[model samples]
Target chain A: MSEEIIIAGFGGQGVLSMGKILAYSGIMQDQEVSWMPSYGPEMRGGTANVTVILSDERISSPYLKVYDTAIILNQQSMDKFENTVKPDGILLYDPNGITHHPTRKDIKIYQIEGAKLAAEMDNKKIFNMIVLGAFLKIKPIVKLENVIKGLKKSLSERYHHLIPLNKEAIDTGMKHLKKFNIEKHIIHN
Target chain B: MAELKLMKGNEALAEAAIRAGVDAYFGYPITPQSEVIEYLMAERPEKRTGMVVLQAESEVAAINMVYGAASTGKKVMTSSSSPGISLKQEGISYMAGAELPAVIVNVVRGGPGLGTIQPSQADYFQSVKGGGHGDYKLYVLAPASVQEMSDFVADAFDIAFKYRTPVLILSDGLIGQMMEKVVLRDQVERITDEDLIKTHGSWATTGKTNRNRNIVTSLDLQSEKMEARVHRLQKKYKQMELEDLRYEKIDCDDAEYLIVAYGSSARISQKAVEIARKKGIKVGLLRPLTLFPFPKKQLFELADQVKGILSVELNSGQMVEDVQLSVEHKVPVEHFGRTGGIIHTPEEVLDALEQKIITHGHFRNHKTRESSIL
Candidate 1:
């Protein structure tokens, strides 16, 4: 199975690192994966994005025009990637800064209150891990154990002490995710 | 067995250089390729394998430093982007003329003149056709994947030392920035001064002890001597062409059309080939791993099999000229490209293949028929 995912948010929101963790998790699971980030000025403080592909076989292109799933954080990313998700795909977003809620009927839309939960947890940096947890809850592409191992590999040794707290944040995000169901249209007589 | 690690192409190149027993790295930081030096500095190759990693003041100084180190028969390397590489052309030419071995990595970004800090194959002509003003050729290796980016450092050094000439790793921002799995080699010891004296004692500038002083210079004022030097370079180039014509052909057995590309463009074209094949189009991809010693013979044979050849690149058609030269009018050769760092999608390439190559075949055949009649 192959999964093409786009993770996007503000530069400091850990969007690129989240994708890296996911890619590392895929590797730990013995899957072929690629992580491509949009580098340059946009990555300094503006909107940032990364395309991560996990496949059982070789990945052909690191760049993609569309994605099977889009995990968006900020309003800018939400506006840009809401429609780019494939039909019958998944769109997971943090409800903190998104102004316009996704209204697509052909795809599944879910919201994780990552910012609020991270604020409660007293560490805003774990916001991405929360969103990642929500994503895994819905998709389950890689196991949680593999994600923990990936986290250890991605984070430096000094940050190893925070893995438990990050793990707690993910669990909270998974518990707090709310699905937004598209209303079915009624046929006129 | 060595462990697999997820790394960017630039990072992999740096790690591989250290593991491959590179004696020194002198490079200036440039976008899309700064990671090469950054990794080297962080790893402290000085402590790891007694390899020296220094960040030069500029690209010019970095390449000149490479020349100095390579003159001593040390395995030296430097990396830069397109604009930065342009600054090193003179030094590269000097090294080529002096017959000094070195590895230069150009993690190419878009350009003619500081175009953009994005992935581009625009440097194809500049790289393969010799950017510097001299009758010289560099062994250019085009790596399509992160694994190749790591592997080709050793290969480039091998060829560089074997022929006592400079070799270039022509990569792009796409590979440099993108992360993928790579199997890194185990650490090898850097060549000691004793080893250098033993291997290249005759020509290397190693203290000039017990032998005639070996002066290294590109300046031969005498026309006849300079011409002989040029002939010697030409002979070495011809030998390289025969020995290092490397390419990979995918799904070309019954292909009606073929797409030729290298580096990152090849990776994208591979996808385009798959997309076209899924739609019942007999399309194939030919990726040149070596750009300078291009796989001309293989392309000539494929020209007879395919109805048309399309050269796809991120530039406004640089390598297409080489493709056309190789085909030699045996088939129609067309170019489809995106300039200024804009990457084309697989669907766009497939559309170009169907429109510019397949559907226009009748017109090309008609033109050929008219030309034959004339």
Candidate 2:
């Protein structure tokens, strides 16, 4: 199946890194993947987004329409990508950032207190990991072991201590997001 | 051989040039390509790699330095972006006219002016067709990967020295920024001080003990001599076409639609081709590794096989014209791109390809759509 996703937020929110991790994992799994970012002034601030597509076959273009999934880290990102989500797509959003609920009833929207969960684990920066955990639970593209391996590779040498906390945050997010999987009736017509 | 390190394409090019025994680097910093200069500067290759690095005041001065160094028969090089490359074109032409061997890299960016610092293949015509006054060609290498950037540096220098011409590494920001592992060369052959070309001995100066030596200027007072010079350069270019047109074809043997792209845009097109393949579409990619000595023959052969050709680039229909010229109207040539700072995604390319099939039967009008910022 063609799984096209866009992870968007401001700079330093780990949006690009999250997308990179996903694309890199897909590559490791022998899945065809493409990752295109808003590699412009948006990288400096305003807004940042990366579109990732992982398919069983080669990816045609890095551009997207009716993206199968989206992870919005901030309210601005949610507003930007909300309209583009496919009817059967899953949107994992940061509850702290997105105050307003998604208007679309066709798509499944999961709200998680990512920052709070990560902060409880003593590293707020792992909010992306928390959201990533939610993504792993929903998408099931790469196994958790591969994601952890990719995460370890992505971490800086100095920040090596944070991996355990990040993993904990992922587990927390996975546990929380697992409740949504039961409703097979929620599938789009 | 060790495992490949995830290094940016521009950095890899710098390391490759050093390993290739490039004697000196004279360049100005421009985004996408600035990392190359930074890599050289940080490494301070003088003691280790035996090369001199200089950050020039302007691209004009940098190209002039390259011209000076190359005349000495040294493997000198320089790099810049589109606007900066435009400034260096005059010197590039001069190097070509003097038959000096050197390498110039143009890490292309969107522009007519100071366009935003991003990946662009708009300089295809600028690099292939002479950007400066006078008829000349710089053996241009368009690398699609950081690995190829390393692979092509030595080849670029070899071609330059072989033809007594300037060679260009025509890259874009995507390749410049993206990291990939590269297998580096072990031995580096550096030019010694003994090998320095003392232009003081040659007629590089007018009054230097010459008993009235004829000027070796591209400007020939006699029309016949000028024609001969042009013919000579043309012959060299012809030889290059026979020997140096490097390209990669993937799944193109039975492609219904062929996507012609190069450099970073070609990498994105590779992703797009994969997606199209999964959909049961017989799509293929023709990635040009050498921009100049344009791969006309391979493109023509593909035109004979494919239903139609789609030229994907990061510019406003620049390479499309070249593809048209190559195919010679044997088949319809369409283009898809996003200019300025925007990068065309694989999905957009797929849409264009699908549109090409669904809309017009075969003969398609050239549609140049302005890319919107997302």
Assess chain B of each prediction and give its TM-score.
0.97, 0.90
lDDT value, candidate 2, whole model? 0.78
DockQ of each: 0.74, 0.26
Model 1 lDDT, residue A60, Cα: 84
How do the residues B264-329 of candidate 2 rate in per-residue lDDT, one tens digit apiece? 778778878887889999999998888788889889888788878889989889888989889977
Off by over 4 Å in 2: A1-5, A19-35, A52-69, A83-89, A103-108, A137-189, B180-226, B275-281, B354-358, B362-374
Q: What's the distance in Å from true for residue B86, model 2? A: 1.0
Worst 10 residues of 2 chain A by lDDT: A180-189
How would you encode candidate 1's per-residue C-alpha lDDT over A1-189 as one tens digit per residue?
Answer: 999999999999889999999999999999999999999988888999999999999888888777999999999998899988999999988878777778899998888888898899999899999999999999999999999999899889999999999889889978888887646322111
First chain TM-score for all predictions: 0.94, 0.87
Clashing pairs in 1: none
Q: Per-residue alpha-carbon lDDT of model 1 for B90-173, expressed as tens digits? A: 999999999999999999888889889989988988899888999898999999999999999999998998788999999999
- In model 2, the number of clashes is 16
